[model samples]
Target: MNKRISTILLSALFSVSAFAAPTSYSVDPTHTFAVASWSHFGFSTPTAVFAGAEGTITYDAEKPAQSDIAISVSIETVDTFVDKLTEEFLGEDWFNAAMYPKATFVSTKVVPKGDNKFAVTGDLTIKGTTKTVTMDATLNGMGEHPMSKKQAIGFDAETVIKRSDFGIDQYVPYVGDEITLRLTTEAQAK
Candidate 1:
């Protein structure tokens, strides 16, 4: 019957749309940065900015849960504003940038939290140690970029990680074992 054929055709069309492939975007290193902050000896909080992030983000606007991200931050790019402290961080006492060189995060799961927010669980690796961590992320904006004239997406995420877990616990209770990481990124379709 005509009605039966129409129903089947409609179902097939919906199925195709539902299973559409996600879009891939290359991270814009110039617009992506990560800030790591920790309490320094209970007197003040010191923050360092890690620039020049590189990675890919596979995003599905229709089904955000299917989205995933992978990013790498170079240790050599860390800047703490103080020349002495920055040099110290690159040494063996802290991050040991010579050995690590980079820190990375690869998402394993993306859970939508409504209102353009998501709980992203991923494996974070630092100094060759990997640990599962979750970041509270928000989709900042998505559309054609003005400067690049390309489809672009932006996000902001925050997570707390313990340096001790990654074998970088120098002062522990004194310098604060837990470090807060905030990431802001913009990616463009490649």
Candidate 2:
């Protein structure tokens, strides 16, 4: 009877350990980028890249639904390739970077979609306007980093948002109101 009780207790402990709590990771700014693209008057598509994202991601491999992420990107980092256009994006007619320097996203829910994919619903705030959006996210890889030797995780996510909805309706239909946003990030365990 004593032996059976000890075995049961050990099994319970192992089972609990198998389902560990979520791990917090610090976003690696150098390895993260946010890209936005939109049609330019039916002629072509222009893309802008934003770098140096900062934030934290809480992840649970066993229970991905419990994970969440919060990140902020500086408006000043937006680069449209064209120097003149980049300046216009930061001006009052567009993002108004002087007044709102940072765009942020905070996850409200995470739903696992199988095969290391998830639908992450979050609140995105830009130029003081907050809107709820969902991104299709995939866990690209997760493990010890080859270079840093730290436990790291990488993800790629994409979503679509209307520029007009965020109060940045400069050209409207001419420049395409719908923008495709993509995020690529690698974070290390903190």
Candidate 3:
């Protein structure tokens, strides 16, 4: 009877440890970039690069589902190359930087697709509007960062979002409703 009880307790403990928490990481701004591209009149495509983002990542390799991901972008850093357009993006008709200064994404779920690939679904908030968005993510690499002297991970993610959904449809059908985002990040374990 005593042996059986001990075995049962051990099994329960092992089960709970199956989803071990992952390592925590801090976003390395110098090595990360978030950029968006939208079409113009269905002919020319222009890109807007977000200069920097700050975030934390808790990654789990054994239990990928247990990972936590969050990213916050400063709207003021949006660079569209054109001085006029850059200013316009923050106007009341668009992102409205004055009202909502930061754009944030917090992961709700992570689905593994094998081969270091994952589908990250989360809530993306911009200009006081929140919407569910999914990004195709790839774990590019995991190693050490020479400068930071810590374990580091690299990721590449891509997602398509509708500007109209976020209430940024200033130009609407004319300015292109769909926007494609390509983001790359290198984070050092904290």
Q: Count clashing residue pairs per candidate.
A: 0, 0, 0
Cα TM-score of candidate 1? 0.89
The runs of at least 3 residues in candidate 3 whose Cα sits more than 4 Å from the true structure, single-residue gaps closed, are 1-21
Write down the TM-score for model 3. Answer: 0.87
RMSD of 2: 3.4
* Residue pairs in candidate 2 whose N, alpha carbon or C atoms collide under 3 angstroms: none
Q: Model 3: how far is 41 from its true place, Å?
A: 0.5
For model 2, how does the per-residue alpha-carbon lDDT over 1-190 read when each residue is reduced to its tens digit?
9999999999999999788888999999999999999999999999999886999999987888889999988899999999999999889888899999989989999999989899999999999999999999999999899999998999999999999999888778898999999999999999
TM-score of each: 0.89, 0.91, 0.87
What Cα-based lDDT does every candidate model obtain?
0.94, 0.94, 0.89
**Higher-scoring candidate on lDDT, 1 or 3:** 1
**Model 2 regions more than 4 Å off:** 1-17
Clashing residue pairs in candidate 1 (N, C-alpha, C atoms within 3 angstroms)? none
Error of 2 at 19 (Å): 2.1
Query: Compared with the true structure, what per-residue lDDT tens digits does model 3 show for residues 1-190?
Result: 9999999999999988786668999998887778899889889999998756899989988888878789888888889999999999989888888988888889999999999999999999988999999999999998788777799999999999998899888777987899998879889998
Find the number of clashing residue pairs for candidate 3: 0
Across 134-176, the per-residue lDDT of candidate 1 in tens digits comes to 9999999998999989989999999999999988887788989
